[model samples]
Target: MAKLENLVQLLDRSLSLHGPRPLFGTKADGRWSWITYAEFGQLVARFRGGLASLGVQRGDRVALISNNRVEWAVAAYACFSMGVAVVPMYEAQLPAEWAFIINDCEASVAIVATPQIYEKCRDLPEKAPSLKHIVCLFEPEGPDGAPGARTTSYGALLAAGEKGPAPAIDPTAADTACLIYTSGTTGNPKGVILSHGNIASNVCAVLDLIPFGSADRSLSFLPWTHSFGHTGELHVMITVGASMALSESVDKIVANLAEVHPTVLMSVPRIFCRIYEGVQKQMTEKPALVQGLFRAGLRAAARQNKGEALGLVERLTLAAADRVIFSKIRDKFGGKLKYAISGGAALSYEVAEFVDALGITVYEGYGLTETSPVVAVNYPGARRLGTVGKPIPGVRVEIDRSETHDSRQGEIVVYGPNVMVGYHKRDEENKAVMMEDGGFRTGDLGYLDEDGYLHVTGRIKEQYKLENGKYVAPSPIEDKLKLSPLINNAMVYGDNRLFNVALIVPEMTALSEWARGEGLTFDSPGAMLRHPRVIARVQAEVDRCSSDAKGFEKIKKVALTDEDFTAENGMLTPTLKLKRRVVLAKYAPVLDALYSGSTKAAPREAAPPG
Candidate 1:
């Protein structure tokens, strides 16, 4: 409590000073239960003692494989309390990936959410030579048999700690707090070594900019394994005494929003995109008069967003529109959301504008896992519509334009307390990304404006040159295509080819509505994709979205699919980022056929307006 220096100290201060205050809310048996600060602290202490009893000494590594839950928080803080470096793995990741991370980090103890997750890593002790114990959060059970010799129930471990001596707590700012493995789009994931100061720096910086406090509450659904969710949502909320509800799943976000009526929401671009699409789809179903009213509300909101003073008549009309239209939109998000934070990916300009017009401000931020996950974010008073705002205090960002033709645009290099120490045990990988001045080369191409707002353009590695020698950034084009309500997810491919082609995943709900209107019937998504009418409709949407793109960047041919790219399918990362390599490999046949002109669909060419 004496001027907290490390993450453990922060947790202690929160417990002692904010005693008896409800910190976390979790649902069970159709009811919500609250865990107070003091209770949470006691649990952490017990868990720490339990871990220490199992020979989890200071500087030892522990791995946690779990979805977001109250116990996950308890386990993480317990690890930090005793100077144990927590290695968090996405529960949805392949078992092989899990084994690799556990072994790579040399974790000694593994804490998993359920028996099922433990089963995935059942052979981890053999795979990870250092692994000595496996703790299951749920009641101890094993898949198809009794619990393994090394396996113990979470409650039993806590009970062991409750009878042991108090856990030790002494950590320096430089001590590693967590090893968060990156969701590798290019290769195997690397363990990003974030020290206590690294994460604490980001939490303090964000708190300085945002007015979050005890009065605020949030419903959290972001995966805790991801740095963005861990440092940004959980740690930040805990640091400021904010209450959080552990959401059940992403699919239940809407229901949870209404149930919690949370004051703050943190999410990725996909959520906003889906919300915008749902709203737009609903508007289309409304009568012309209602649609006109919604449009008027949006116009007035846009004017106010631009700082325009409304005349008396305009103000009155705006008030009426907000009452009838915008109010309902707000209600869907629990009617009390102060603002939403968008990160994890580049939000489409259209989605941002549309959400803004609905009177809900979505602040966009930019960062990678290596920077404690938050380099820049748009604060309330100093936000630019499309740009990710200025760097946080103590963070330095410079554009390395040496390799780029454009002087203003280049790779973003960051030097700050939030930057990771280095990739754990991967010196060669660390050297490649680390600059002489200690800055981390982010590999994201972007430019800072005169106002200091950072505008991300694309991923340096994702950019590819066509056969005609024209370079195309697929991210921007994919983002643009997703703005259309019909398209949910898109992957652009044209590397060393004559032109770009795409694999598009349709928004099934919106597509169903349109199909119903067109008198189209299909038993399945695959059948729908094969229909000529459905194909032509999607083609028109692609043409419209690609109109502003460069000739070489335009999507020439597209293969539609009803299947969405998801973490389970190995097509998307846990954070919802598309895994380009996996996607291409999965759809190799379709892509090859698209390029060979063996498909019946005609290739669309991009031409300038007459």
Candidate 2:
């Protein structure tokens, strides 16, 4: 850790290093607008001026409700410039969600990413009366804009900024810089207070891994509301002076990749997994002999990756396949893609290896929102497939001493400068697990290998045992099940039974096509799940999921579910992580029906392993 005296200084220094370069660039209605290093400096001044004009003083709380966009970054810069703590809530939040966050932060100013979000806050200011200014990034379509009837567009705010002087914010590292809410599965989200030092330090650690500078081009699509998007990509991009593509939507990621050909691409596992699936679907259109050759080549590549010297024939076969088949797949990533930092969740092992084979490096890392979001990562030159690499420079990691686990694994813990100070206003809760020595007990269960790599086995809170008293790690089963094209999602059950069972959801698009080819018909395709053909096919897939497992952990039965497990249904967190407790309660009836040992039922319809 380069002991930073303060974050404001870090920003100043970084700007000096990357000065007036293309700090941000985005398409506005098919036209591109860019802010250079010098322009970026002026904008920071303007944002500060705007905040001051709105009567925001140092240490005042300002809440930001927005989606992922370059404009959000602008607002963040504005808040930090004045040492006024910024609270960021996800755009997916409803009116009530914003109300909770606004009340918790006691914000004096709320910046809505869109007019839509401003509309959501209509009743908040009325109820809380603490909120004052409402800044809008876009004209969101909604019933009413932000509370207090105080709404101003970014353009209007910047104009207001021009009329005021820059606020002199001589802030220290100790000052609270941001408040990011945790995606609560059980209750209202907790405000995680991260000081400027915490975030600045964490981003510096990130820079050590992702080798991009002002010259390197990057695409920003991850939601700024999330730590991974904020700290991992945006912060690192800013520090390095990397040019930002600033995509308009996720649907345009492919086009952006082609248009910008970014050097640094960051995304969750789902994006890559879908790409891999799409590639495979295309290959199915080729002649049988050609397809067989490609498969043979892929197998040979895997063998070569494992360090086995391929026979001349195998090498040639794979080389031919790569040049003709795989090379085109690589082109889709703009043919200049370098670092693909996968986080937010584990990228599928298959997805990781597949990308690696195409000559693009996909580095996997692990962290939580609490630890300023990054504790460990695999740099380009430093990587291992089965592990989330060692602690980043300055972060200290230790397995929890109080962890209760079987001999094979224990809960993971960490300590470092990257750790957030504490949960806002939750001293009692903070005192419970955050140790006096600074260690934070991560609820993830894993054991460090002799090489110091962390391998998370399962969640400590999600553990369940079989009838034989042997524990089952649902994650492994979940990952393995997702490997099957027919299996979109699966939750392994069998807490107290002889063996495990699973609740399965299929990918509707893929499953629907299969149903059509089988001459199946119904009011809705989900009803075709009970057809003998679909049952037999799904049964085969279930068998495949349990094939490599021991009897105790093997899946014996499974029932197909119709609906997708989603955050709206309380079965998933906003991060797309499964809420095991919520899922079980929501689908208790399905579990009971699946285990009832009866074969008669209608498939209402159907859902991936993470």
Candidate 3:
């Protein structure tokens, strides 16, 4: 393959090389449909023409609001191919967020997924005066369902494109290809303007690290609007000629896994954690003999996964276990899964180990939107268990020690072609994040080990100080808490307080089963949370999970809640990351009670089983 100068050239080369190969697949009406690379290219050309007919030219911004769908891919590539910068927004975000992003980007054209999305941002022109056209992916039911006067159906746009001239534009690698907004955990989202070269460099570097080919197929469910999914899965898969099946939804991932039977899977850690919990839960219901065999297999595999030489006896035992036990676990993932890529958050070590023991390699990488989302990743032969592997080829990573109080680790900074130009129109914000030598300061606190593996500890901004002047990193403790099957989500509190405390969201399914076994009954989620038995059980789990933490880091008190923080509730980002500030504000009363010494009930004697 030639060194592609820009994204458009990459796309053209890919199409020429894999024109007849299946590129994308989707399920509709209980059937699977596929589009070849040639067909997809044609769709992109038509969309490009359509966009051109709407006066979308080079340097123009086109905002797209949609879930993970074929149209999202088509629109994004169309915009990239024509030198128009894409601004992707989560379809489910609030109207206010949509308005803010649209106005901030000064988008001239908008492509929406459905009438609902169009309606959500119909008044966008009032807020974003630059926005001139609204294109809907699906037709509206009636005039009332139609968006503002500027809106047109996606089909109509394509039909008009058939009569319009193909857009003629030339773009350099430095030209902005996309503007990905941050999830805005601490404040309003800022647009990270990634250039064509930035994304192309990342795609090329990642390809050199992770192996993919025409034979590989992937099931993609991660939100396409996010950088991780956009660059890692969509762009990487397309560049490599691998087929991708668009999942119906996140809730249908397990079913789609079987139906798609993908050779590769890309997802966040939460999905893997849930799979680990589900597997454990199912095993507990099996016969003792079955459970014993599974545990024996897991033990044997774990030793091998740790790079320990297995004795002949252990090797033979593992081979037998693979046939009887591990193979069955692999069968759940279509029995052909070769690799699973985890990113978007720190995958728990336990879950990663468990999946690796099942004979599937889980490569956990780390990056940010500003870095075209891939700075480091664990490849097939160079994986480290606990560390996010070495930086991809051509990227330079350095630990900045000046800002850290501890000399061991500091902010992880990057200098690479993959790094974004800067945040769009936020010179002050960009100045704050950009280092003296042009390195993008990743707010994550981590250190590089002797072997060059990156160990991300926690977020520097997320660290909090206690009344005793001890600074605590919450993510590490939260990761531990989530390892407990009884706990789903947790937020560690106590910034400038006596000791660390946590607001925990119980794994309702597991908790309900335990409650049933204990003869406990509750009508509502709030009532269940307030129950003495539930609180006691949660506290015990919290203590057990946080046992490895230092004295100051251990969670002293906890408040249980049945409500899981979600993006819809403003407690989590669209990508499922917790919005710490939002969560703190939402749970103010609970935190106050814990610190004020009003809710310190002793844990009951009967602790839930692991």
Candidate 4:
């Protein structure tokens, strides 16, 4: 494999090597549809010409508002080939966020997924002066030929491009390729200016290590607006000539998985967590003998994972469990999922083990959008259960211990070609993160072990100190808590407080089912959560999950809520990371009451572990 100079070269190489191979798949009329690499190349050419027809020239930015779709790829590749920077915004994002990104990037054209989105964004130009044209992926209600008041259908642009095709122009590696806005867990999202070299280098490095070939397929649901999905999945898959079946929606992932039978799975931890919970829930409904056998099989798997010997009985039990229980579970994932790449957040160790035990190799990686999203990842032949794998080729990982208590742990600083140029137009902010030596200070706190695997501890901004001055990294704790089926989402807070506390959102469906089985009656989800028996049960779950945690890391008290931290709720990023500040502010009274011991916040203080 030749080294990629830019994304254009990457695309061209794949097209040349595997032109007739399938590149993308879409579901329509209850079946999966595919587009070959050569056909994808043609779409890129037409999209490039279409962008050109809209007066979108090289160096200009184009805002894309859509989910994972073939057209999204078309527009992105077209921009990359034309030396145009793509500013991708999530469909789940608020209109104001779209306008802000568009204005920030000075996007000349905006391409949306549907007419409904078009209507919402048609008036964006009123606020975003640089946004001169808006194109809809679906045809709008109008005439077929000409543009409509600065808005037009995707069909029109493709037709115009076909009439006057624009030849592919490979941009220099140093040129800007995309402007990915951070999920903005705190303040306004900063646009990370990633160059062609930045993303291309990441894709190349990843492809070199990961053995993804033309035969592999992925059920794509992670938003392309995210760097994890954009560079990790989209560009990497295209470069390797692998096919991606775009999931209809998050709700349709399982259905699409069975239909697509993807060999490779790339997703966030939440999805994996749900799968773990689902499997656990299902097992509870099984016969006692079956449940006992499953538990024994899990013990055998754990022993195997640790290179420990298993007894003949355990081995037989594990084989039977695999054949009876695990095989059925694996079949749900199309029975062909060989590798699952977990990024965007730390995957729970339990979930990772569960999936691996079921036969799918789960590789957990760690990176931020600023590093073109992949600094280190676990692959075959080099994998650790708890730690993210070694840094990719050409990437250097260093830990700055200036602020951390531990000798070997601190901020994870990354120096690599994959590092972004800078945050777009935020020089002061850039200076804060970008080192004079070219390394980007990933605010994430972690340490590279002697084995060279990176263990991400927590976000520096999210980690808080207790009254005793013990630093608590809430992410690991929160991740463990959510592993319990009773807890949907959790945020740990105890900055300058006596001990850590949590705001937990009960997994409503699971909670409701549990309540029904326990013969507990409640008028609402809130009432059920407020029940003493329910609180005691949930606390036990929390305790069980955090059994191995350090003294300061355990949740001393918790306040239950039905409100899930979601993108729409303004308490979570589009990538599903908790907005600590937002969540803390919203639940301040409840959290404060936990310390006071006299408030009506329904904060049940758990007895300290003996």
Instruction: Give the Å error, residue 492, model 4.
Output: 1.1
* Order by lDDT, highest first: 4, 3, 1, 2
| Model 4 root-mean-square deviation | 3.6
lDDT (CA) per prediction? 0.84, 0.76, 0.86, 0.86
Stretches > 4 Å off in candidate 2: 1-6, 29-33, 139-149, 303-311, 599-610
Off by over 4 Å in 1: 1-4, 142-149, 512-516, 519-524, 601-610
TM-score, one value per model? 0.95, 0.92, 0.96, 0.96
Q: Give me the runs in candidate 3 sitting further than 4 Å from their true place.
A: 141-149, 600-610
lDDT-better candidate, 1 vs 2: 1
Clash number by candidate, in order: 0, 12, 0, 0
Task: Assess candidate 3 and give its TM-score to the true structure.
Answer: 0.96
- Residue lDDT tens for model 1, 1-610: 1234578877876777677888999888888899999899888888888888888888999999998888899889988988889999887888999889988999988888877786677788778888888888988654423233277778987899999956567789999999999988788899999999998888888888888888788899888798989999998888878889999888888888888888888888888888887888889989999899888878777788879998887787779888998887788788988878889889887788788887778789999899998999999788888888899988999999987788799999999999999999999989999989989999999999999999999999999999998877899889889889889888999989988888888887878888989999987666777777887788789999989887767887888776678888788887778999888876766766778874433211111111
Whole-model lDDT, model 3: 0.86
Candidate 2's residue-wise lDDT over 140-191, tens digit each? Answer: 4444445375767677778778887676576777789889988876677889
Sort all candidates by TM-score, best to worst: 3, 4, 1, 2
